[model samples]
Target: MAKVNKRLAVLVGCNYPNTQYELHGCINDVVAMKDLLVKRFGFDPTNIELLTDASAVTGEGSSSVVLPTGENIKAALSKMVSQAEAGDVLYFHYSGHGTRIPKPAHIFGHDEAIVPCDFNLITDVDFRQLVNQLPKGASFTILSDSCHSGGLIDKEKEQIGPSTYRAASSLSYKAKNIPFESILEHLTTLTGINTSDIGTHLLESFGANASLKFLTPQLESELFDFLKADEGILLSGCQADETSADMNPMESGGKAYGSFSNAVQ
Candidate 1:
């Protein structure tokens, strides 16, 4: 195990206030993670940034808290990575909604993305890009408690899976299908134009940085290059082909909780 000279965390939780995608336990999930980092990992309270919709409710005295909008989340992540140095341990925990977008014409299957409160997405490519910014000897760990979160770290090897059970390292698993209608609605929000054509329209309107372009073909060497240089681990709630349950059981004090988040905490 690598000793951590410095400890930092960026925890984001979203309840999608007043929206159709409202969730109940995301804020609680972040709270739990914040507590764990403070007590279990010995992270300084000042070194953690908690971004969530419940900032007003939970962040009474914390000046560093903010809402989990796409812009805010991205900026917080950038700051966390920018401030890290060698031998530091940085942990990012996201407890919220996730979506699977259609892969580009050149690629096979799908790509995974976390849904921000604004419905703007942060995809796996974006994460790998962030990981690339880490200084040597620094480690970045991601814990995603959301739907379709598997492979969020992009081409990182699997230590536990069908591959581990099989004779060799290669094992195939089917990815879950996310509705195109839902994906299109969210993607079109930025461009204000809706078209059945995904590739051309998104490319023309939003260009490369567009959320959907994360699935588009890129130089594998550069996009996945962090796997070679960085110590990053992604612990997802469920497999790519599985749905994670968000349970609000009456027996559990009528409070909602992500099944995976509750289990991990």
Candidate 2:
């Protein structure tokens, strides 16, 4: 008989303050996952961690922590990777909004980003970079309940502000101010439909990296190889163009599971 291994789970959900933009219902998903893992998978509660917006203020659970900003997220991920041990299973869940930024000169060489919150956004390259850093021989599974989260797409044209216009124009002349609505329309035309391909592509790219090593036979070659290169599994909530819905109405106080969460439960 094959040996059974211990697992570590990290659950996260975010609802940005002052905005109803976060419709993914990540908190409920995390909670549901926590219950399912305990009830069905027989995972110890002590092995799991949860991070969320409210938790940032309340400071709950041993494994559960809160991320107040983008910097906090970076630090948390770094800590999580550092804490991982070989031969252990790691489950990570993230539910929130994804945004695109103007690609920088480094990786992918195009402007794209995933909207994280008010102050932070995660680019495709940035996310791939993080995934590449995971330890070997560990089973890492990730569920991202968000959209348009795929690979780098040019967002330079989508940027607005006097400084951007001036930089692009090279001070040729003070042109009449352009409307943001017009720019958005232009961006839509240029990018067509922004899909979740960016996220999948990033995962694929990471999985393709040559340095990955796999330790389990049950793991399929393609999926394993891809993840070894990238080192994780991401079960996204929907396709690139689709939006993940909140099962509960905003006014309701009772917690509810998202479609993916409900299915998992």
Best by TM-score: 1
For model 2, the stretches where C-alpha displacement exceeds 4 angstroms are 1-5, 20-24, 55-65, 102-114, 150-230, 249-255
Query: CA lDDT of each candidate?
Result: 0.70, 0.48
* Per-model tally of clashing residue pairs: 1, 25
**Poorly placed runs, candidate 1 (over 4 Å):** 1-4, 59-65, 106-108, 162-180, 187-190, 197-221, 225-227, 250-254
Clashes of 1: 1
TM-score of 2: 0.57
Give the TM-scores of the predictions, in the order they appear: 0.80, 0.57
| Collision pairs in model 1 | 176-241
